[model samples]
Target: MGVRVIGPLDAAGLDVALAPFLNAQEPTAAPYVGALVDRGWVAPTDAGTYVLTQEGVETHAKLLERIQIQRAAVTAGLTDDDYRTLLDLLQRVSANVDAFASTLR
Candidate 1:
């Protein structure tokens, strides 16, 4: 999403770039745009446009790095134990989320 939204100089340009992830002509993209604003990953220009800040670029790069790492891991042959470990870790994370959510009940 950052990659799609970061390079545009204006909302129109952003709509074009974001076409793949969103319906550029609809209100469906507002949440995505709002999230970017909330995170300080993007800023509004005096011209009513948007641009990526330095932090956004840095964060995008780090996100790309993690994606590449995950892709590499998937392509690499995993031993049974490696798969088990990953599943176990994910299960633990899910359990933690459920536990935390339950507290808000």
Candidate 2:
């Protein structure tokens, strides 16, 4: 992953924070925000905004690893099958992480 400089962000702030990298308008950003919440990267605050949790920080670190792997695969001219395999591996890993985290709660 190309190390993108990120700072604290909320749902409404994505356009500004991601301007240099992505043209993520609210239409696109909403689903991503929902997914982040769904995956435990973000929590809805009482103020009706979202904040990144400790789990979000940790999950982002893992996502960076996957980004790097995919970048390498693309650079090597790997086939779509290789990408699919990586996606499958990531899904299994996510399921395992979810299960393990559940045990602690």
Overall lDDT per candidate, in order of appearance: 0.74, 0.72
RMSD (CA, Å), candidate 2 to true, equals 12.7
Model 2 clash pairs are: none
Distance (Å) between predicted and true CA of 33, model 1?
1.4
RMSD of 1: 9.3
lDDT of 1 by residue, 1-105 (tens): 234434556766766666645531363555677799899998888888877788988997998989978867884897778878987998799778767886886
lDDT of 2: 0.72
Off by over 4 Å in 2: 1-5, 18-28, 45-49, 77-105
Worst 10 residues of 1 by lDDT: 20-29
Residue-pair clashes per candidate: 0, 0
Model 2 lDDT at residue 101: 81
lDDT of 2 by residue, 1-105 (tens): 356645455666775565444431234466777898898888888766677789988877898899888888674875779778888898799778767887887
TM-score, prediction 1 = 0.55
